[model samples]
Target: MRASVELPATLPESLRVQLGQVLPNDPNLRRPASEAAGDGVLVRLGGHADYTTVTQKAALRACLRMPSGATLLIRMATGSGKSLIFQTATRWWREVSRDSLKPVSIVLVPTISLALDHERSSQAISGLETVRALTGDHSSEERNRVLLDFRQGNVPLLFVSPEMALGSLRESLRELSLPDQHPARPNAVRGKLAAVFIDEAHIVATWGRSFRPDLQRIPGLLRSLRAIDPEIRTVLLSATVDAETRELLRTGYVDRDGRWLEVAECMPRYEFDFVEHRFTDSISRDDEVLVLADVLPRPALLYTTEVEHAERLHQGLRRRGFERVRLFTGDTEPSERRRIVDDWRDGRVDLVIATSAFGMGIDQGDVRVVVHACLPESASRYYQEIGRAGRDGRQAFAVLCAAPDDFKLASRMAVGSTLTLDVAVERWLALLEGARRTEDDDPWSGMPQYRLDLRARGRHIANPRVGERNRVWNKSLLVQLQRYGALEIASSDDDSDGWVAVPRAGNDGLWDATTCKSFLTQIFGARAAEEERAREGIQAFKSAWRVRNDCRLRMIYHIVEAGAPELSACGRCAGCRRQQVAPPHHVATGGGGESLWPDSLSPPSATRLLELTETELARPVRWLDWLRGRGVEQIVVERRLASEIAALWSKVERDAGWVISWDLVETRSFRPMNVPTALVLSEKSGTELERLWRWGKRWNDRTHQVAWWVALRGTQIGTRSLQDEGAAGIQPPAHLPSEE
Candidate 1:
């Protein structure tokens, strides 16, 4: 039986030995058919035999039933079918709304390669042939064609970079919210925009500050979209989202009065066998790379921190008779980059010497090795990049070669683009002056808006050739202010000369020195602390790679999965090999958990919810108006009803000043609310009613002067009645009543 076990011929001999001991004796360890059944949407979209993990099923169900203004963050492991969630949702929407209004979705990617990759893969999926990637690489004709199709409701899945999203696609996106008349039939509605997906979402927090400020502007785009259609949903997808990134996303994307659901399977990849090496100098590292190039597995990726290094390595490997090696970097031309990706995927290229520009969302599954020639800037980046390997569920290897200078380079890269407080203030003042000259106030919000010049120079700057640098700093300042809720950037033009923005209400005094100073200090201080944390993370990674006594994979996982329980030592790692520990017979690869929603209680279809009659909608609208008239500042409802009510309330009140929270009886933290707020509890569960009762008593004890009110969903709370307390009984909408 052992001799008969078959493995892929492409796998390396060493990996073969490691995997040989782990091959299960029962070759057919598949789950029973009954246990492997999938959701109807998944089965229809994927196949009858398709099996999905619990996390994927839950996320898909949520997506299908996602309410307006809600944000869903999915942090699943690489190769875990994260893309399936959005694909299924998009197709499901198309199927359900084919005869009515067809809805479209936009997928924002970090790089052009990723956009093109998605577009190519989407062509094979059913009901997604209209998918198109609109990027600068396309000719004007191609872009116009894509735009025409999008405007006609022909394009269903559109892929674009952040730049295109802010530039040419801005108007088209906004037009999605406006009702369109059908060309063929009178009084017929055409299409509506349903969702926006941000792929590789971690970049919004990590790279948006400096490298691509447009990523940070995405929330502003969503704000504009929601202003028109309050029911549009936003989905953020990534393989890793650290605490800082998660917090940034919450502040930027999640609506204050809406619901936030995070679906995460925070576990390290167990398929990788890690190997670490430290060199005394570049000369030694180069020689070592040459030696390993011959012995390392084929279809490998060698990463460098800079373009020059990648070019040099490519040349050296080619000179040493490696004919199938290629170079890819930021400077690579658009056509060549596409060609490289194609060749790499088609097995024409055996090795790729590249910077961070390549291999994001690339779906080559048989890659066996990922060699890092230099230290990455952060642990998240390191993990994301190395995840390019072992995607086929086979054994793979991660080789790290670091030098002393690499650490310095990584530290410098981490803290290079942050601005000082004084400089930020100067830049802001200069931009504000330019905006005053433009005098472009927004018509909708009635706030003073402007198209501030990105190239504006401060009085202290004498150099005339630093316009580009000035533009970067100006955009960075604007992004920081926007993230802090000081302003909103409405849009930008293709020339990239300026961005239209307006001061958020109550922040109109941002031009005042005292107020400006206070705000800038908070932004700068938080940025400084973030930089410090990044530096510490870099140091920790360096320390982990330097120490050879411990399992490198475990140390790396600890850094990336902060506060996670210690994982079992990988038996194939260097430390385990030194200790001669036997490899495990099998390893679990995908996420594991029960479905968030049971089959019997599946959520109502988005179509059904959106089709509420005027009378049905008016009931919730009237309830919200009454609450507003009563000066209710805080609204507490069960998790199920919060989203529906919040959507209704947003339509009536645009400011979102009221705070909406869940009544799940869990310990949670909240931002301080200082207004003369009225708390309205709309709960039906007995346990939650008791919890709110205890909460109201504590609130009265703390604030003796403030008055609070209770709004019960029903008259009875378990065995007790609230009729004597003068509390009002507010029933939920007739269409969506409390599930007592």
Candidate 2:
């Protein structure tokens, strides 16, 4: 008769070898709590006499036998051992469970920093193979290897960002590869993914609420994961989220019932502390990014929404005679980001001019400060951004400066985010230019399409847009370009929108790219030609992020963060350096409309508003009218969205202010392009006015262009509510007394 033995289903054979002393039923017999080295691995947690509350023991055990749990959501503070739970779970599957192949797993992270961090953490455990990170951070060849390895069961652990993992998984796979020497492993990837770990799972739903459409694809992505990978496992992790999001992730992705599964089969071990601040006009000095110079002793980081702010602070610091200052931003290359991180870790640079992309998976442990010169878009984002502070159980500082208009700008950006097919390619090319190889007969084609050769020229690409292809440069370029007197992004088509020429004097790219053979391989040699051109195009838009309006800081914050930074400045009353929470401010705004168009549906008020605008405010913003008005309003009384036009307006209006400088609004802000006295508005700007009144040429002139669209939208929308009082259709919707 076969030996009578029992084993759980999740574990596989290769992992079965390390099983003997694994299932310690004698809870007290677990590893001693004192020497419990949770480093690199989340070990010796929640079972012994002195098993501290720090391990979240009981909660984890309860999840193991949960009746309706099929998914796990670990909502812990930033710096918390969120990933440890996963590492532990992976180990458990290897040591105790029984199955065929290693309980194959996939780890999906939101950023490369997190990916690398997880890679290190996951690899520390024994019997874990095929552990690789799939991100914009890797080379085309590296990513190809990762995808191929996972497909052929060569890699047991795979980490990736939601963007690549969901939207371009197929494309990424098509680009799969292996080293040339390994002929035995030709074409070995197809339908072999066990479980998927959705790090930063909040994007699955939160992005929609905040206006990030790239995130809109998330819900479907989750469903598709299950469909695509037969036995895919999912582990979602985030900190400081609301119950609604929790419910959404759990119900929408994991479990059918109200319960959430445990990913590491471990409890949440986190301690949260919200430290606030208040600042005033006195906080910022003229000619200075050094607004807040003093930093905590611990390895702290400063998160500024705008690079202008960062530049200003950096310049100010220089003026203040501080040297070890190093700034990290989208403009900086990956290698630079890595170098800066390493240098600071090694006590080389004192401060880094960091953008949002600066701190994703950084385990600086003792990060003392996280300053927000501008506000983030939401409470959720704020928590995530500031969570970067205080990792090593040491005190950390998170300072947020509140400005009233921040929210509107942030909302506009949140609503407009989408993965432009062409834009993604453009970013890839720009990175390739610096890495060009002259030795190849087909120089351009030799350019690597997927690899981040961009990282090689770290100093040249200092602080590249975080997430490179993930999400950076939307704002930093705008702010920095403005400071450099570069042309504004949202300008006449003839002008260079994203074209950033190498500085004739200090530009390192010229020397790097034109140098020797070694330099080529170190930078752009691997990228394909098609990809090189895409970079040039994306380079054009990089400067466009900071278009401006009355809501300057808000827009700047929005464009830079990519997700609106919340208006902690509520009404400009909540000051960070001081400690004051003010009520939310507003422009005293309201609008109406039902079905703004004929074919489209809209909120009853919106549609009715559209009808009124036909005679009241006069012409509509567009044929789409109520369907896509407000530039950023995703919900026009229920209709999801019918037009990208409305989205573009909101995006430019919201983000330009933050990323673009105020100088760009009224005049060309750089040399050669003399500072003009007047500005030009798009022709569509005047459409909000009644057709009859539009006959007047004043609004059409470039001089009065700025007010054209504002008046149009204001009048058309302002007159919406008063349509019923139109006095038998005699007078058209006149500009309201205050607005006119």
- Give the TM-score (vs. native) of candidate 1: 0.73
lDDT tens readout by residue for model 2, 1-740: 01122433333332222221221121121111211111111223211221122222312322222232245555444554556555545544443334333344566665555676677656665545347766565688876666666666566667766556544463332222222233433454432344455677665544543233334334334443333332344556665344445545554455323234432211111111223222234243222224334423334566666667676667777878877887777667666655666676566765676666566755666555566655554444555676676555433444454444443444443333432333423433454454333232211122211212323222334554543432233322222222222211111111112222222223233234343233333323322232333233223222222231122223223322222225323222112112443323332110010101111222222112222222333322343233333332221110112122223223321121101112211122111111111111111223323332332223223222111122223333224422432442222332322224
lDDT, candidate 2, residue 354?
Answer: 68
Model 1: per-residue Cα lDDT over 1-740, one tens digit each: 13235655544454445445433332332111111224335555543223344445446656765666689888776766777777777877777664466788899998877887888888778778788888677899988988878766788889888888877887777777765552432232245788999999988877885667778889878877776777788999988787778888888788645577776656677677676667778767766676667766768999999899899888889889998988889898888888888888789998999999998878788787889989998887898898998776666668887777888899988766767888888877787777742455555467776788888888878998988877877877888888767887766554668887877888756766457777778767777777888888888887776675667667777777533565766676666766776555554333323213121321211110011333433355555555456445435444444445555554442223233344221333221132334444454446766676666545444443123344543434457554433333222222333326
| Candidate 1 residue pairs that clash | none
**TM-scores for every predicted model:** 0.73, 0.45
Query: What lDDT would candidate 1 get against the real structure?
Result: 0.67
**What lDDT does candidate 2 reach at residue 286?**
29
